[model samples]
Target: MQSIAIVLMGIVGMLIGWFVYSKFIANHIFKLDENFETPAHELNDGKDFVPTNKVVLWGHHFTSVAGAAPIVGPAIAVYWGWVPAVLWVVFGTILFAGVHDMGALWASARHKGKSMGALSESVIGKRSRALFMIVVFLVLLMVNAVFGVVIANSFVSQPDAVFPAWTAIAVALIIGQLIKRNFKLIPLCFIGILVLYASVFAGSYIPVALPETLFGLADTANWIIILFIYAAIASLLPVWMLLQPRDFINGMQLLVGLLLLYGAVFFSLPDITAPAFNSQTATETPSIIPLLFVTIACGAVSGFHGIVSSGTSSKQLNKETDARFVGYLGAVGEGSLALITIIAVSGVTLAASPEEWHAVYSHLGAGSVDAFIKGGANLIANGWGLPVEFASTILAVMVVLFAGTTMDSGVRLQRYIIQEWGDIYNLNVLKKGAVATLVAVGSCLLLAFGAGGSSGSGGMIIWPLFGSTNQILASLTLLVISVMLIKLKRPAIYTLVPMVFVLVMAFFAGVIKLKEYWLADNYLLVFLDAVVLIVSVLVMLEAAAVIKRFRRGD
Candidate 1:
């Protein structure tokens, strides 16, 4: 019953956000016009810049931005208590994420589809652009490397998901060709989903696992290398060929998965077993004040959203007016996923009572994606009468697919950033697509293997820094958008308030983590943390200077 109430409240808030608040922002703040020519039309090259339907574009944006962060973040943040996590996700989606994401898409589209880092130059200053790109690259590096580890981890732990996960790619490739040939999307979507689920059913019956070691590397390490190799090829292909269709399919699958999870909550009416505010937190758990904001980043507000909005989604925008649907609603979709995740992890399905709940979540980061999977599977088995094994496979594939899509977009965005640097410095070598992709993929590989050593799990070594760094990027993105709004003479308060709030929280979190890293003698994370903090401060100061000049009409 408590879980049901939470679900109802979250859904209602999101509805109001999408129908009423989003429309208001779209009309007045963004001033979206259907007559405006978007970059997809202006720079239609049949590759990265192809005009796409709002529905398909929304699918891509939602899943790519989602990844496994929302689930993993909320699942872990429950150590602080579900109330704080839920509040941040709901209000943050309405006030912070919706505005920031839509603003980035609009800002980038208005400037011919430049990434936020590149767009910073037009809105702020040249030095801000360089600084923004550095932050952007670091965030991308963290995302690509971390997500590869996440997906590889999933494959190793949930071998049953392997068959359906790879099967999704083949299905997407076929769907992509069909979409390109002018087939009706309605029919293609149905067929693709049917095939995907059929594969899921087959996967449950036949689980696959790699040998203990492949090529003298651990299975997880081999999977990480293989996943990146796949992502590199997928990134270089035409947007219509793999990225768009694959994300669309994954988006639909996630929607179905969410409906099932939410339905189980309502049908079973699970009680909330976790405390509203934890009284027995692990002694090492940091203060929830600043950590909560950064811990549950993607579900609440994330800097990575702006990167995808401006980098990939902006390039595929078919209409300027569609920004509201693709951007705001995408945030809404992810919030809903996060909402259910909180319930799935905290409800009776996970623990019969409060004591059991605390035992399971004895420490920060105790219950992550695995907790969500187990709880969600139990819910499905209880409510829908499905076998837990099959339910587990479905949810596992959901996480893998979402992470896979993010990897695709992350690598491609990294390539775009590298090529932008090439243009800025007059280096023709980096301008080539293949060369840029190598650098993007190569960098992530270096981080993974170089840091993790034999396990290729080095991404996890830097994972703790991701939350604070990602939110800082989000605040910086909001800062860029706020400055743009002010320059246009429109009301900028919407973006400004979120910017100040997120920056302060993320900055504090970074400082806290820096101290912890230093004490632990993790010099690599300490160095990376210092770099992000310094770059963020410099970019903020540069933007402030530009805003001051703009206010003076200089």
Candidate 2:
């Protein structure tokens, strides 16, 4: 009965989110002008800003938002309990994420495809724009760093998964090129992707030893080096060659993988294994609330989505009205993905005896996540009549591909942010692509310092901080959406409700983190927590100020 309720709640929530509430938000609040020429119409150049078919645009938008973070965050947050985690996915998506994403598209389209920072200045104050840009840049850095670690860890732990993963990407690139060049090779490309997926599973069984060059410095460190090298090359590559093609291919893989996962969970009808509610663990859990909000903030509501939604997607939008479909629908799809992963994790871990579960729970290292995902994959394979190990390997490949897409997108977005900062600062060095690349690379490098694999290490301690950062970013995102809705002289309730919800949750989380740090004896987490608290508070205050300004006709 409870499972039925959850399933029903999720379905209804998604329905309201997509067809009813989201449409209301779009029509009444956004007032998206159909006549207003979008970048696709106004700035079309047969490339990034060219108008595309709705399905193709949807693919682009969905791929941009889908990534490894959605998988990791939900996988970890289920530790809290399936109840809160599921609710977070449901309510958070409908009330906060769906609206925020649609609003971003509407606002950016209104501004002729100006990026979020530019939209911020037009909607909020000019000063707030700079702050928004900086915050966004930092968030992107953290995303790149963490995702980098995510991919590297997968490669190191499941070396056999690498060939199939890279092969899938190679296949995607070929398809993208054939489509671009030949125009009639789409069917062939699709066939190739299917073949490549099967081959990746086959390749996973033929394992080979990883070679170490600089004294036996552990396979993990070697993975990191290899990852950094890939990031460097991918960053330098054009979008058409590696990045875009890989995204298209992996995006399809992600969709199929998610569908299969959900089908497995649903058809198998696994019982929830975790406690329904565990407030005790919820409070002092390894996560700093603020940090967890930042870390897990991606699935529920993310500022990053706004950037992708507005930045690249606006150019390809067939209609201003379609923003709701691409942005809001995409967000809900992601939240659903998160919910599925969380339920799977909670079910598997809870299936074990309480004492055994507690032992694993207490010392849940990074390997624990890999194990959980593998276990879930195996369960699906067992029920579906497939090889368990092969299923697990394919799952690992999908995860790595997800991370790769995220890293490339992060770097590209960060590059643009750097260029924008350059324009704002009036620095001559910023004008040169080489200099902009340097600044962007430096930002990525700094973030890479903390990109240790997600093993609940000290780096994992930063997870909560990432969550906090994302919440703060979401607060800012909400402010932009609300103000833009107001500027269009639309009803503010759609924006107002979500704006208030995100602020309250984010503020509560931040305050909790600050209090914990103040009471703790350790200076490091104390300082880290303190820093997060201050930034969060200031950002919230700024968001409040913007909301007030919007309300007062300022």
Candidate 3:
């Protein structure tokens, strides 16, 4: 079948999700009230809480939650076949991700923009809150550290992307100031795009490369340190100063990139080179049942989205009703990216034939972000007549910028978690923004350098556990939302159904990884995996007890 068919299917599915399902959810299930003052107004401190336009907030939420996972996960999961990967992205987005993301945002906005972990205390119990926060902190650490490495590696490998990558920051700073002065958004958006693409064009001509070693560390390691430092500073800044504008611009860039990719599909009309289901499998490949769900977390449903929804987005929501737009549509935007990634890697753009595609995906974790870049560039070059080098540079910069935004939000969220901890225990030290920022960055740095030595690749060591761990967190977030719905005396079957399915699959995936870690003698992953399982089970038990008590009127 033609790859356009797959594209059409995904587009139609997501449209239905947005226009029909999301409206029903907003009106009935979530019951978002436009008059309800959000935390951004209720707790407006001009630092963390500032009322934001829905469109701008959507951009921040979308780009922050996207990162590289949607690309990387679906890119790799095509090993199972394009059918499973595409279906998961489309249906998962409509049924799972939309509700999860939107619900988290609504829940948080209702609770004064508290993070999901902190909000758990009100809905579930105090014990559940601490357990929930632990999972959240671990997830943030993994995200920030790994994304620092991801951006650093992208800079080194694709030097052309480096100039445009950093140029974006300057554009965002200017845009932020202008927006604060009540500048018109449409014009600023156009100018930002023009400047950004001009940088991309210029970058292709004047590539920037760093030395092999800097400050007695390898270039990648040095880049990692620099990235974390930048993230720390970015996180410390007010949302309007950097995070909001930067992410908004990056989100616009991604929209243009997606249009180019989808245009390539229409013009070139490439054939699906991958099989719907793989009869021939690698010996090392895990079963497709649960693994596929965990693998394609972001494009479908992700726990990380909950973090961003509750962490930063909720704090800036202009109106409670905007949750559907900022959260659910933000999820649809990611699903679109993931869909294009699947086509880029699975269609003739990547491999000329099914056999060639199979060879490229010979192993379980064979295809990745590199494959997406190469394939997407080729597709654009073929269809749009752009030079392959220029196309590659655009896509590379897209990946780097996305990952960088995610790192920014991850560090900020981590600091929030730390501050919440201080409030929970009356520890004044952790309550200070600067001190919390230090602890956040310090933990990620220690994990990177201490675990990976001078190479600073330790984040990847724990990355193998991220897929299962992330999905499990998604389940837990859904669980928290479901509990909130029940407590409010509303229909919770929407959240409850998705929560049950995700938890079962994620739990199974964790068990599978635990056995693999034990056999490989990767005790660190084994211990971490076991801890996640235990905490998840305990949280579930706590929720069950609360429900039981509620039913008993106790």
Candidate 4:
């Protein structure tokens, strides 16, 4: 029954995404003027604005947006029956997330690839643009902070993951440099990924381990420093050698992950191990509503999509017509990837055995980071030919890589935002891109430091912020998208409907949390909760105001 419903949901999601949301993106919202050609085709800069094939672009787009959100969200959300959560995944993708992403692409494309900040100013108001930047800045701060902690936890908890990932990255860097310096060495990159995965399996069997001697220096702090160092180098390096090549090599990790997840589901067919409903789960839930929305945010919606849409993607658009297929359809496809992750994780855990499921959740620290690994260990021991520990280790390596790839992307975007902020605000103190890079790196470091604690366990402080901030950003994005939809003179209600829902759910959640914090004995969470709630509401109200004014034709 669950499988049938999920399959049905996927079909419905795909259909609505293709037909309903995509049409508006391609035809109405992003409709380019007949006189102007897209920069991708007209400018033809090989470095940034070069036109590429759709498939390649899709690959780039998918990797850029795909990360831990989809998998983590559904895994956690399954606490609310697969019915409610899956409904959100399917319906949100079709109506809310699909519209938000596609609309962001179209709006940005029409404006000649200006950023989300610039678009907010030109379309809405200058004040709103500044607010948007401030809001997004904070959101990125939370993102870097959370991901830093997540990676650290994965490594610290599962010591086996650290070597494989480090080795994989080192191998990838060498292969990338070879490919760039000697273009004929392309095949070696693929070979490196294979060798790296094989090494992970071998390490699992042999158990080459690291010392737990960093008693004072938390794992999160270590990750922050490591990520900063890597970012510093990555920022300074040529894209061809590091970023692009590594993405291509690391890209297979996602593919392998999907294949393994799918195989486990079909072969093992593990019963779901979580509860469908429980009040206790809500109180003890790691997810606050604002936080849950933020955490689960990518599959449903995100403002970051707007940044990508207008920044690089708009410039790379080959045809105005392709925006629908590329932008709208592309978002739907991205959502589908998230859906796949959710389905994969959810299938292994269910609503029946909350305690047992909690055990599985705790085992995330036990050399395996996902339900697939935990569930698969049992299944593989029962069904598959491979050893359970070996299979589990393979899954861990893939997850680490998946989380690590996003770190690079996050740094890159953070740098861009810092540079733009410096220019717009006229902060000469920030110097050129070099200083901006440092500032971005420094900011991420501070965020990492703030959450530094018992590696993964103590990092929970900032983890809640991701979902709250992410949802808040999504609301702001919906405002811009709604305004654009109105400007294009489509039925604004379509965009407005989902936009309103996200805002209401997030706002109410934020307010309730704020009250709880205020009434609590702990002033720290009270203060934090108050700030999170207030900022979130202000952003939502600001967006609503902009959309309202745009609608009134004022």
Candidate 5:
């Protein structure tokens, strides 16, 4: 029955969005403070502020903001069909990405941890934190050049998911040397999830490949310059060796690839054959009111999950009421992985046929990662008979371990915003951290070989300016967390009503994608969508002049 009513209405809208984020946004609007002092126990310094483990920092903040941009923006916004992309991924993850990721991990754990570009000038001021760290360094250089062309287009279109996504980087560098000697966490997370499912059954009998051109530039742009030279030496290590045990074995391989695609669609039900409101595929795609709010930014609302909720889950928050279970259950686990990628691309285009779902949605380009890995490998081969190239190599090793833990935490949040702009200008080689991880993986290898267009398709030439600069960085991180809830009076009308609907639908979807990249002239996505609509209209008129000078008292 319509594929068991799209997995029982997306698990009853993620259990009514974690019961309205634990009853009305965490006990009536962002209360949080369970004995406040946080920055991982007052800067624990075991490197990058330690104190984690709220379910391993909610599986490293939901696999570092669940990558593959919520399965390529709701599999190209299911051409505005699947019920307006599942009611904007279930009421935009219960009222705009769970209150802009629990008001950016409760305004960066109440400031000390600081990051939504250093609390956008400590709550809207000081030159608006250098224009909010140059719009968070052009949205982490278009999230490290579109997840370095989405893990080099899932390793040149799934060469058997490059040996179980490089065997979870040698089993997260041997569980970061058994968590640097102390090892014990439930048998090192059950032997690192049994060595990530025996490297996905030894990558189904060894399947790695490359060299179809190397220096002349092809083998998927030399596997995205060897995945940004292993994300510039794993972004200068020491997150307990290899980004916290390779994001705790890629967050148990993203909860064992979303429990085998929602337990094979609730035990093989598979029905909904696409159209739930196609309107002629939203009149040939693009424009489902501000390009479906900038093409379903991260399953619904993501100004880059408030930079992984204040750049790295509020610096590994341990308490202060674990910021509503790690920023509203890590945005309800990426709005239940964008509601299981809109019921696995509308029930795998109802088991494809309309000339293979019009050559994978005729309008929205780059056959949306081959129509979301052939409609989630024909809904896990109708729930059991596996082998659509082994269920598209287990959905291309869960899209290269969720875009390699989002380009390994977008190159450690672009090496802590290029070592905080080299301590605000002195520039002693961007204050070290291996020269800001070699200038953040050398500006993501010069924007992944200069915005790769062909074969490389540098993340599909900026996937619609990474969904309108990720919903204009979620409408300037909900106007800098509604000007830090009007400097703590605490009732900034719940982040000023989704920050005026994501600042007027991400500045009218970056002025209709800057007149469709200036009539296809495509001056680099018409100068990066007119510099993301002029630095999002000067960070929304500097957060409406700091909410009209904090209501006149300024």
Candidate 6:
């Protein structure tokens, strides 16, 4: 019953959040004008700016931002307890995330669909735009590297997922070709999904596990290299090709998988087994205040969500009113996924006896990525009587598959930022897609080697940085949106308060991380943390300057 209640609560909460956001925040506050022209229509290039179906665009937006964060965050942050994680995922999305996401979409549409980096120049100032661009570029670099690590690790952990995961690319390519050739939508969707599931099932019997080590590198590292090569190629392609279609298919898989878990829980109604709190092991657990805010970013509020909104989704929105659904409701979808994760992990862990529960969570990584795979798999298998090992492979494949989509998006966004930088400095080659892509992929490789090392241990070392930088990025994005709103003489406080709060929390978290890394002599992370903090502080200072001008009636 506990599991069922948790699932029900999350669904009801997200629906309510979706409704309130569309009605009060998006409709009343942003005053969404249905007839307003959008960038997708005005600049329909059929490549990057393809005017897409609202449903397809929502799937893309949701899956792109809906990658590993929501799954990983709650899985790990359950250290503080499932209750707090659940509360934050539910309320945080409603109050802060929905507004923040919609603000990005509305701001971008109103400003000709420029990314947050470009918007900084007009809304804040040119110098800060450069600063903001660097921040976004660095963050995306980490994003790509992290997803590479994630995909590689998924393959290393679950060999049965590999063949099916790779096969899905073919499915995406075929789907893209069909769409380009003007195939019927209904039949195509059915064919695509059918092919996708067939691949997953086939992959189970014909697992393609790589050797444990190759050329003196961990299998995970080797897999990371291969994944990046794919990302580099895929990222350079048109959105409608591999990126959109693959994401759409992955979104469907995710939807069906979650529904299966929900159905299982509703039927079985498992009891809560994990402790409601774990403060007794204070040394092992983190405090829930600033850490919780940083740790559980995507499920609640994330800066990257805004990036996806303003950078990609805004350009593809077919109508002005669609911004409400694309931005706010996409976030609500992410929140619901996070809530489901909390329930699955919490219930599964609680289902175990005390001795077994302790054994499961004994390791550092146990509560995080491992937990999501095992816990989520447990929920699905136990509920449906599926084989646990096979269902686990299915879930692992799902994670790696979405990780690919996100990495592709990250590299593409990085390319855009680099080209814009070239425009600022007048380097023609930089504007060239080939040159910009090389630079983007090259930077990703460097970051990958440093962050993951040969074995990818360094990836874990810098994991927390993702959450802090993510929230800080959200703060910076909100700052610009707030400035834009104030300039138009509308209510800016809707975005301002969350901006300030995120800025403070992320800034504090970064400082603490920097100190810890310095003391541990983890110079790489210490340097990374220093850059994140300095850039964020400068950006926040820029926000201050903008606010000052507004107060002076400028």
Model 4 poorest ten-residue lDDT run: 360-369
lDDT digits (tens) for residues 400-514 of candidate 5: 7877887888888888888888887879889898889888877767666555544555545656677777777787888887777677777777778887887788788788878
Candidate 3 is scored at a TM of: 0.99
By lDDT, the better pick of 1 and 3 is 3
Pairs that collide in candidate 2 are: 290-468, 291-464, 291-465, 292-464, 293-467, 294-466, 294-467, 294-468, 295-466, 295-467
Assess candidate 4 and give its TM-score to the true structure: 0.82
Q: Is candidate 2 or candidate 6 better by TM-score?
A: 6
Cα misplacement distance, residue 443 of candidate 4 (Å): 1.6
Greater TM-score among 1 and 5 belongs to 1
lDDT of 3 by residue, 1-554 (tens): 47888999999999999999999999999999999999999999988999999999999999999999999999999999889999999999999999999999999999999999999999999999999999999999999999999998998888889899889999999999999999999899999999999999999888888799878899999899889889999999999999999999999999999999999989988888888888778987899989999999999999999999999999999999999999999999999999999999998888998899999999988889989998999999999999999999999999999999999999999999999999999999999999999999999999999999999999999998899889989999999999888888999999999999999999999999999999999999999999999999999999999999997889
The residue-by-residue lDDT of candidate 6 on 353-431, one tens digit each, is: 5455555656334677777777777777778888887777777887777778788888888888888889999999999
Q: Identify the leading candidate in terms of lDDT.
A: 3
Clashing pairs in 5: 303-474
- Model 1, stretches more than 4 Å misplaced? none
TM-score of structure candidate 5:
0.35
Q: Which residue pairs clash within candidate 3? A: none
Off by over 4 Å in 4: 19-24, 32-52, 167-196, 202-211, 214-220, 236-239, 268-270, 273-295, 308-355, 358-372, 376-384, 450-460, 520-554
- Judged by lDDT against the true structure, how good is candidate 1? 0.93
- Model 4 Cα shift for residue 169 (angstroms): 3.3
lDDT of 2: 0.67
In order, the Cα lDDT scores of the candidates are 0.93, 0.67, 0.95, 0.61, 0.76, 0.80
Model 3 ranges off by over 4 Å = none
Error of 1 at 145 (Å): 0.7
The residue-level lDDT of candidate 3 at 89 comes to 97
Give, for candidate 3, the lowest lDDT window spanning 10 residues: 1-10
